[model samples]
Target: MAVLGLQVVFSLVMFTFLHKLAPYFSVGRWLLSKRLSRYLHPTNDELKQLSSGNQPGKTTGQTSKAKRRAEQRRNAASAQADKSESFTVPRNLPIQLDQALVEDIDLVPLQFYSEYTWLMDFSLCSLVIYVLTEIYFIITPHRLEFNLSILWCLLAVAFCVRVLASQAWIYLRTQEGGERILLVTFTFFFLVFAMGVLIVGDNVIEFGIEEGYKNFSTSATKFLEQQGMTSHGPVSFLTFKISLAFFGMLVGTLLTFPGLRLAKLHVDTLKYSQDRKITQLLLQINYLLPLLLILLWVKPVGRDLLCGKTFSKVKPVFYEDQFEGFRLLLVVVMCGLRILLMPKFMQAHLNLAHEKIESIKKESGRITNIELQKTIARVFFYLCVVAIQYVAPVLLILFLTFLLKTLGGLSWVSLFGETAVSFFTPTSKPGMKLPKLGGENSTLGTIMDSAAEFTSTLGDIRGIFTPVWYRGILNFFLWWVLTVWFSSTSLGVMYYSQNL
Candidate 1:
């Protein structure tokens, strides 16, 4: 069967064209460039002038040269004394920063802006291709030999993980701030937690990994035998579970800061948007939805309770199939909600400058002009970094769900009145030969056949990379990732309420 399908073509276009177009037309850049209320940083000279009782908007007789000489004298005296001395401005001085728009063109040079823009643009393109693929399947008679949208999704997931790892790396490399120690501690904790959870019987957690793997192994063995192939089935069960735990550790590490940042954004958004009751309500919902998603997979809490005996006596509220579809749908909706409220979150992050100024106003000690300026300017400087942290994890879960739906052979059509599309049986017309590369005797055709043969051989030996195999693996990781996100976010919220 030819693997080069319409979806594959779309993937190729996305890979090639999007990189060029992203700089000029990117959702990340658009989101960041939106007109926002920002506080300007006070210059060192301005701070000194204010300290010297020079009110804003009033011209003093002092020349720029005079100010420089005065600053130089103060610096020399402080240097000789081996200590610093600086003038202090009034704590409650009425200082209003000049408001400015975060121009789209200015974002090109900001740290992480390019990375954020590319990730967002690629993810968006991949999503469009995925929807088109779903639509293509609906009207076409041919069954997909392989969903190439999975490749796009896999790449999206990879990029998201890389962004997350890079973000985490920043903390690990820090010499001070206790951030490295804190991250290491959390990674170790999550690792221990992941290992501990693996021991729990399927009855309690109901991850179904064990059952899924057994089913996969049996299917792979039979399929290989029929193909004149010999092999032990997939990796050992113990090895599989151990690998999952280690992956959980990595996820835990990557998510640590994002979760913490999420909590901070949530609190700040809620604080600032108090006047807009609707926005506040949405903020609360966005913050809490992950917890709801986490609970849905637990058999005792989610499945047994809602779809339990009481509801099952007459008829189940959700059939087994419908329930699974609902879980996928929920993740999609949650991700959408976050994206929708992105402006509010970004604005809240931007307002950190104002908030810092307010915080400094409450302090009694003198602050240097450089310190004050950085306290305000740093927020704008790293706006894109904050944005990357905010969006990476959300995209991670969203694309992962896309992969789950395609690779697990689940259907979106099922949610909208039709039965789920099952990929288990061939949907193409009977006896139709799947397309081959070029002519049978051509070099391209031979190379394609060789490649296909190699792929088959690899699958036969490594346990068939079947939909069922992916279903089980994706199902567990999807649930685990959700649990980790909610856990970390919950901890962050507590830390803010208690400590911050």
Candidate 2:
């Protein structure tokens, strides 16, 4: 009740400001507003002019002279036809692709642009609340009754999942792309992989999920008994692991298309940026960072390598809790790097038009003008959809980590030892009688009394959803997301490499 008033006021003010300002300003729109060169699709006249070996606006005499030169070359080629395989090369055909700048106005009509804007705006709002909450906690000893920031982060994650699922659904609706089958196949594979990981001994993987669940169950059982409710813990061990496996399966399906899209963009980005060694290096690092995060939880390799002697049970370096802190930090860094390089990835995708035009030049057959136009135009048209695929997974992972930090009782500053405090501070000591309000028998007294009751109810709810349970579930989720991301992306990269 002490700090609730200020927190509520701050949240409302920020929410209202964002809600109103969103129309005039948005991070998503701004990101897409960056001007990039786009190739203009060739018109029928242009293709015909190239195919006929004639230049536009040429005088009649110049056209006749050009035709005579072409006829002479064809005669010479025919004279030597018996000596060499016959082929006709179009003369005076130069592919000078005109370029235009793609701006925010161009993206406004693109598919998924609104959804992308909403997602980015919501993510920004969620981040603001989280940062404010953290600052409030740091300065005040009185604890937050219920962290609204957690609610915001949860909403952001849910929204991201919905967007990704919709993207996957688009593939399913097509039915002929094999994408539908791939999604189903990969989901099952991840489910089996999740179960396998869960069954392995903690000595090998070190998730500590089993221990955390045991502690949670015992705590919950005691709390239930004290409240005169009967329970055999919350769920059986087998049931828990099965539920976890299903969750992992969901993550796998959501990430499948994003991973593949990333791989395609990565390969294209490399091709588009052949001369820029630094950009290529960053792309590789961003692609491989997930694997490094996954290895951080592997007991024999990640933890043992850094905190102790390799392949040994010994411990000598920093505290075990610090390892968790470092992992969290790395995820944050990777998310930042991905955001920074988003423009590069997006531009690489946009350059598909140029690439397609170049590839068409290599073919000997004539391409219909409509087909050529669609090839160049669709790349810029689907810009927003591609942006969604790139941004969704990164946002999901970022906010999930924030939820894990808060719910798992971990701290962003765990390395410096400023761990998160308890959720609330009581107005009075335990077992003490409630004091009379400052103004007895008045409206203010009644309001204070109601506030106290509300705070108590919130406290009871927090007790049921304890951090021990959160630690188990969240750790499993974070690990599963990282594992599936690395596996899918690595597979996608290899697939593209071989096929291309």
lDDT of 1 by residue, 1-500 (tens): 25656777777777677867865688887777755655566544566667777865632456476653343233223334433444556665556565456767556666887789889998899898888877777666776356677788899999999988988999999998998998999899999999998888777777777878888889877886878889887689999889989999999999888888888888888888879989888988898888898888777777676666445565556656667778889999999999999888988998988878888888776666555665776787788888888899889899889988887778765544343445422377675454775998999999988987897776665455667777878877887788888788888888887755
Whole-model lDDT for model 2 versus the true structure? 0.77
Give the CA lDDT, 0 to 100, for residue 206 in model 2.
73
Q: Give the 10-residue window scoring lowest on summed lDDT in candidate 2.
A: 420-429
Q: Write the per-residue lDDT of candidate 2 for residues 1-500, one digit (tens) a residue.
A: 45465667667876896789988888888776655656555445555677677654432445576564443233123324433332233322466666555656666767898899999998988888888887776666545456778888999999999999898889878858788888889989988998899999778887778888887788778778867999888889999889888888888888888888888888888887889899889999998899999888788787778777573676646466677788888999999999889888888888888778777777775555555556777787788899999999899889989998888877766554434322332233245466776786799898989988887766765677677778777877888877887788778889989977
Clashing pairs in 1: none
| Model 2, residue pairs in steric clash | none
Candidate 2 lDDT at 151 equals 86
**Model 2 misplacement above 4 A:** 1-3, 55-94, 309-317, 417-434, 437-458
TM-scores across all candidates?
Answer: 0.84, 0.83
lDDT of 2 at 481: 79
